[model samples]
Target: MVEIDGMRLVQTRAILNYIAAKHDLYGKNLKERALIDMYVEGTTDLMGTIRVHHKSPPKEKENNLSLIIERATKRYFPVYEKVLKDNGQHFLLGSQLTWADVQLTETILMAEEKEPTILSQFPLLQAFKARICDVPTIKKFLQPGSQRKPPPDEKFVATANRVFNRK
Candidate 1:
């Protein structure tokens, strides 16, 4: 396995684009391809925002997380909901699994653990998350050691849960 210690565009968005190209997830035409790009970038931005907030200081983590979550809901949730509403009950691109769905699901699941109430505002995104979790490929990838909860960190998770009334 090749080790990656730092950032690489080739290893990030480009890698996803390459996979999409290989699997033909870019859709059947130019317009559809544009939609795919929209979803991919939206998903990437949401995840990147969460990552930044996740690494912030504890005293300010809640504020950072709140900003990130708020921005995501405001900026991208509607787009995702619209895509799912227009396309079908499968992926942002519909029926077939795409890297966009994979990345979006991962980010949502991680965010859910922190702010479980976040997806409640967007029912379609919630369903999208559930479907992604149900996939064998994603389910297996997310199994066991794939995602480690932030070691309790009750101060943050618990407080957020209480404020949001998340189970």
Candidate 2:
């Protein structure tokens, strides 16, 4: 939860929506907003899998990782791929960047840390991840000296920098 000017925001989705609204990342129209919400919820589901995997026993980590990768590949990535293909855009919701795009990027980063090859099968998803990371503000924020919660692996950082065209 976060408190700003005496107002408190709780719940992951609620906080994300609030931030998106404040930053004008929620999309323009009602339909677009609904699409964004859909994708955000999808990402949240992927995050749930990640959380379970994180808390699982070491012996079970491999199985959990396999499950995560399978779900990401068979379930999540294809849906996003179709959305991108149908929209003919780099982002999840047409030509505009939405909070869903941000959430997907985060999901990709986490998945990459756990399974580096998880994105290889989905070219469009890979490109989408790169595009989100390529945004100027996001690129800057992801640079070497910037802080990242939980501190991403050095290899992941290098890969992200390369993908984003950042030094």
lDDT of each: 0.74, 0.84
Pairs in steric clash, model 1 = none
- Report the lDDT tens digits of candidate 1 across residue range 50-164: 7766455578888987887788778777778888999886787778776678777877876776687887789888888888898887787777876544534647766776788
Q: Which stretches of candidate 1 lie over 4 Å from their true place?
A: 1-9, 147-167
Q: lDDT tens digits, residues 1-167, model 2?
A: 89855779898777878888888999898888898888888988998898777655567879998999999999998898899999885788778888889889989888887888999988998898889999998898878777766634557656876798766
Question: Against the true structure, what is each candidate's TM-score?
Answer: 0.74, 0.84
Worst 10 residues of 2 by lDDT: 148-157
